[model samples]
Target: MAVTDPVDIRLLAALADLGKTAVHELAAKVGMDPREVAYRLVALSGSGLPLLVGVESDPQGLRAAIAGAPPSWANRPPQQQFPAPQQFAPPSHPVPQQPAPPMPPGPGPQGVPSGPYNVQGAPSGPYTVQGAPSGPYTVQGTPSGRYPGPPPRPQFAPPPVPIDPAVSTWGLPQTASWARGDEPARPAATGKRGKLGEVMETQGLEGEQLSVQLLEVQDPADYLFGAAGYRLEAGERAVVVHTEITNRGSIPFASLPDNYLELLAADGTAIGKAPVSLTSRPPHKIGVKPGETLGGHTVYVLPDATRVVSVRWSPRPEPDERTLTWSIED
Candidate 1:
């Protein structure tokens, strides 16, 4: 209870819930540096607050503790335990302890220190030739090493794929396909095509193969927009176009015809879809499954006197010359 640090209290709570955790694991949970957490744990244990019952020395025991295995020293201290780190020395004076034995220059047993493994090396000791094995290594079974490599990287989950509201379609499984070194090159498209309104299939930029057909056109004086529950104005006439689209290839088609529907006037003017409509399927947001065909209607309202010479059917607005145009005029 004497510990006033909110961070220390949070760390203690984490230790309680987790039983015995490594310094790195505790640091990750509490968002603190491993060194800082280790120092604090040492201080807390030395404070006689019963936060840590005793220091673990056995390699297998420490490993079991880190692995969330039942703690060996839970309610009682170890019968024979190593000493805790010394408390902070006064600013003006230094604290002295027993000096560590000198390590011989030649290689020793298993390339370890001459004496028993000292948790902390001498305050002033020369470097010893202790080569380590390759790959990850753990110290005191605590998962630390002399030349500690980079910290473990975080694993991130992939972003969710957007769903289309038009229809229930199964998305193709994600695949990474690469051409082999000896694979032959695909021949270029000769750009062979037919006039607008003719039933023809083409591949989209995203590799979606689709077959599109502009079936019929009608200009009506009275128009009923069922969705909005409204009718067209007296002077305005509605131009409705019936169309059919099919997903011709293995890839799924997710384009809505409403976005690319355009009405071009005789004098080089463009008109968008009218606010009034009577059709149930507006082709505004629809997806078609492979080998499936869907029919829809798009309506445009224009002045009765305006001469609509053609209906341009492009995959998108601002399309290139390859886009199709149908003669809608009677």
Candidate 2:
């Protein structure tokens, strides 16, 4: 029959271009795991496609296969052994001789014996060299070929500046209204839980005030699934949750407000939202500007038997005290 899956089609196309290749090589070309590629090729062949998947032994790997075996010479007979090549003595040659010259020396330049010395000028003693500076030098203050004294050390350390608890350590304040010891303390995240339809005030990582409200929850939302041309497995069902978020502080909430919204099952399991979207229901946009409110619907697909007890929202991947949860009633 015909190949419909995009991945299979791509793999077949790459195979056609390559004519014949190993499974790993084909996988590298199509960006798939070698095991997966081999499985797919076998499956396609079983489907009556003209494909063959098999492995072959490498002839060049015979040595590796027989590793730890005795050396070839160990099994050879004495009569079959080859003799070592003979060594010949090199021919001798007479080197030329020369007459020696007379010597007349006590001390050479710099008062050093007529031998190698590291000093440039006359040496005062074993460790001291004449015409050289005696002290350390600063990098920028010293001139070329001249040494200067060590850099001056500060007399005392500067006084420590007091840290304001209200100021954020991330960076400078975003707005002029935010000043040290002037802005009110942030509200504690304790007791942030509420029921559906109740407005919950929360803060983002950047301390942006936000008002989040769970507007609606539609369980077993099969109509949205069928309308959006999507299908669910036999035992799975879809859910749609409506939420509204309003930015109350001067800073903008740049993250998707409902990105972490999940359905908490009665057994303490968290069902995350599906990646699919419904055309009729708008998904949460990227950012919510200051003083602006936006409403969006989040969709989830879970087992039909799961009893969703509450809807939870978090600014991060994991839930924390800052996370807001709204209870769902049967």
Q: How many pairs of residues collide in each model?
A: 0, 0
lDDT of 1 by residue, 1-330 (tens): 487999899888767645565565556545577778888998998988776643323333233334442445332232223343334633443335655456444233345432333424343332232454332333444323243233443322223334324323323211112112244434432232344467766665456787777776776634344344656666777777778878889877654544466777899788877544464545444567789888888878788888887676555434443355666655
Positional deviation of residue 100's Cα in model 1 after best superposition, in angstroms: 66
Residue 241 of model 2, lDDT score: 98
Which candidate gets the maximum TM-score versus the true structure? 2
Per-residue CA lDDT of candidate 2, range 260-316, in tens? 788999999988788788999989886899999999999999999999999998765
Clashing pairs in model 2, backbone N/Cα/C closer than 3 A: none
Residue-pair clashes, model 2: 0
- What would the TM-scores of all predictions be? 0.38, 0.44
Model 1 pairs in collision? none
The reply for model 2, stretches above 4 Å from the true place, is: 1-191
Misplaced by over 4 Å in model 1 are 1-197, 221-228, 279-285
